[model samples]
Target: MTLFRHFRLLPRLVVAIVLLVMGVQPLAAQQPLTRDTSFTVASALRKARKDNPTITLAQPAFPSTIQAQRNLTYCTVGGRPLQLDIFYPKAKRSRGYPAVLLIHGGGWSSGDRSHHAPMAQQLAAKGYVTVTVEYRLSPEARYPAAVTDLKAAVRWLRTQAGTYPIDTTRIAVWGFSAGGQMSALLGTTNGDAQLEGSACQTSRSSHVQAIIDVDGTLAFIHPESGEGDDSRGLSAATRWFGASKTDQPALWHQAGALNHVTAQTPPILFLNSSVDRMHAGRDDMIKKLDAFGIYHETHVFPKAPHTFPLFNPWFDLTLEHTVAFLAKVFPKRP
Candidate 1:
């Protein structure tokens, strides 16, 4: 039998797979968590500095090697113009390059697209057209608004398909935390009109060929989920869902990526941290993926922080895994 057949029984099996394939550290060695821990580059860096004070936050160079078009308005919703940044290689390709939409995660309320600038620049330098986009957060809008805004971004990409150095058919979404959940949903629900909101009025499709979900919860109602815990003084999920799980159970389930997965869903890559709660419904989703014979890969960095993708060592590894998976899913043209 395949090692993945017993996904429920072997949640840590992913760690072993990654360790053997990538030579990453063992799962037993994890960082210690604190009481008042937060999930942000700035907040995590403070704790990471304890280990390596010299470690600095990743920043984009003023005159980067790659070409960058920053702050281009992609969509206008409710008088608020949503913006996006595009990064492309200096040498334009006649056939265009694969594009990746990088999404930032801050419980769906706090982060901006700028958090992914460094990552977009690096991917551009490595021959991919990358985009970082802004969406209406929970404080600004609610539930489907963020999803609608993201789909609008995809449509915007289609509008600029031939104009920019991007291959519209080979686009993908890579997101972290809350953005991760959105990414998975985007991948699974390709062309679902309900999520394709009025943020943009384009006939283009929001179909992503691939998805990379980093530490995003797939199911909010699952036993593994840590969302909607009012004991912590208004959890992130509750705020974004607009009510308690008991108050609006259907909405909570509607937002879950696990419920949306289908045989037609595109390939997916799950990059995760040590936090079990973050891996909510991941194994189950993989079961569905496996049953459908859909392509998927899951890599777990045991004992790593929830926001490891923003911090070094982990960030570098994340990029390595990302590039490798993208190459396998969408091979470069000869």
Candidate 2:
């Protein structure tokens, strides 16, 4: 009996020995959170160009060593630690770098920070300090909860400006699908107290210098338009808002990004599919932007679908426009 028991321990010992011999590092250690400080943008861009020639839509403009710090806790909501992944250039500079808060899309219910990590990586490689954040999802928290989380994340990033090579003053927000709606709101509601959530780091401004909305709904109250589209049933918006338009008409209107647009709103870039129904109030919003003399641009991919931003060819095109816009809005530091 004693011999058999000792042999049982042998199996565990063998496994431990195999792990030791293989030099298996801890999960966190294996995937380092901090970037290697010595890398630079120029070298990284050069490598990216050489390795990914096909992916290049334009000349590789910004060359920087991109470093990603994953799963950094930004806020605590409902006892859950809301996290964000920060991707920044490793190149050392006197001044901090411009940043973009990249939000993922899943109809405000299913997406997480890592959903858009590839895009974030691309942006980072181009010298922008990009952050992909996780917000409180619907079925977990409702309407303003995600918005509030995003606001808090903006402030949190500002707070960490000193730690990472981030320029707090030149932050932008970019979102896809449901994320687009959130980003639009952030741009339109710069100083609105009512939309701000009860999260920590509220002292800092949640305002962004620019906004990029990719196929996201601007006005949920507007009837769906465009061909092959019958008036549909309850949308993700209705579910997220927790009520139908008829039940909460005021809320629906209030949630529309167009309703909040003003002179103070920042420059916006809209990238959308030709046949997407979510672009209900885009024309009207552009009119307001024109009236206010606010800088705004739009790109329509005639053949691409609603989720084109997530795929290739279109993604490269998206990045080309995005990089151009970022350069114009927040120029590279000397």
Candidate 3:
């Protein structure tokens, strides 16, 4: 019996020896994995800033140091496919790079993910993996729908971390206008089940480590907010809620980013125009942020418009502030 057992095991041992000699990895040694490289956005941005200390009036005309992977379908809503574009740094990082989810502003009505592609590329070139996303718009879908879609995108990004050179722990969101509102909500509403829509990758957390709001409203109830009805048929906010402010005041309050702030809320950076009425409740929200001992910063560009981040001079300044803020909040790994 012992001799018979030895003969049966002989073939397996011989095969293992042959594989080792031939340098063939056995099935158990193979893994579904992505190769990591030692490259980072922080190091690249630092070098870029040092090489060119002057801020330019327009996007640099030179070849981009990033690679753009366009139109990746991340989720679907109402049978419509939602897509996101990813910008990858040319330099490889072994530990992976911090990520930013860029949401466009179109009053929750218009605008597409492509709107922020240039900015995404710019950030990617500096060593970050940046993505621009598309969400359900108002009139077609009401309040929380867009937020849900955005959250789903976050989950999708997290799920793909293993396949991409991304640091799942250091994801952030940046938005403009309506997109800023969504970004603020994403930052403050982390771990809240109510806002996590029934989108794909539902098991993952949608929480972000940092948020950058460019002229996005923090409080809709504030008198200065332009979202409420102004003797018009219905305010944009009311339309978004699918009910008038008088009918859904609770929903209005729930949608306000200020309502969700707590010590657990991620650090935020507000970039606004000196005179933009959209940021009416900023002071009050800032007070809350301070009370909660959260780190926050505000930069008001004098004489700039609400869409200043889209233009030069202001864009350069915005980028400067953003780079500094992100560096402090999500430092690169060695």
Candidate 4:
């Protein structure tokens, strides 16, 4: 009886040993949760608004403190023009202004650059040159296409440093939802050949100095991740990855920001909502960051919706943290 009981641990040990010898790191532990698409920004916002009728989207449009430039062609992919909108502070800094690129969230399928316009406008007024860029969604493009488009956007933003007030060295990426995941990836995958989208044609680097991930999952298949459920037979992540997690485990793993973390990863700030699933892989990623001495910060809104940044009180808090983080990470120029 004792010998048989001891052998119960053998199977687990054998698996770990085999993985180590094969140079394979196992996936992050899986978290059990019922999948629900109601966590989306739109659905969450509706309920949140019903509870507080006074809640409104952040910032008024066409603010006088900032000068706006729209529809600037950033990249041309096979004759399809990709555009980005830039927000510049009316009062220029002689030493060049630190810049931030804002990416919007839409489950990699349905979102536009304008989704982050309010964020860009407000950030620009705070003396940071801000840009909101458009990327190919899954409806038309696939996994790497979105990645490549964002990288190209970064490159384009860099190339404009000479033409604009941007300080090339002090650039950051801030994103919401799916955009948030991409934002983390941008920070971790800096200089990775596979992720460096080549459509921009510029030799300038697509590096970001910091990352702001607003309720984005760090890993798609982790114990904390809410992705790959397919309960409805077609989850959003599936559309983005072009297949089910079971069918393309490696590709799903590739898109995970947690898998790419290194000592070189830039400082990151996470602003999360009430959804536990959206907090996916964040703690584990932070552990890795700590191990490498990388700077990071996190804050969770007790009951705020996933799209809280789009509304007032939560938006105000988000802006406060964002500005402070940027100020700390990017030293004042002039």
Per-residue lDDT tens digits of candidate 3, residues 203-275? Answer: 8889899999998998888788878774867666776788877777898888889988889999999999875
Could you give candidate 4's per-residue lDDT for residues 1-334 as a string of tens digits? 6743664667876655666677765443234333333344456567878767777767656668889889999999888788999999888677788889999887887767777788888889888999999888777778989888988888887788767898888889999999999999999999999988667755989888899999999999898788989987888899888899999999999999999999999999999999878869999999999999999999999878788888888887898899999989997753
Model 3 sits at a Cα RMSD from the real structure of 15.8
Per-candidate TM vs. native? 0.85, 0.78, 0.81, 0.85
Q: Model 2 off-target regions past 4 Å?
A: 1-64, 224-234
Error of 4 at 6 (Å): 90
- What tens digits encode model 1's per-residue C-alpha lDDT throughout 3-32? 446644665867567566776766575553
Q: Over the full model, what C-alpha lDDT does candidate 1 score relative to the true structure?
A: 0.85
Q: How far is candidate 2 from the true structure (C-alpha RMSD, Å)?
A: 10.1
Better of 1 and 2 by lDDT: 1
CA deviation > 4 Å runs, candidate 1: 1-40, 47-56, 60-65
- 140-183 per-residue lDDT for model 2 (tens digits): 77788899899999999889977998888899999987799889
Extract clashing residue pairs from model 3. Answer: 37-93, 37-94, 38-94, 39-92, 39-93, 41-127
Candidate 3 weakest lDDT stretch, 10 residues: 35-44
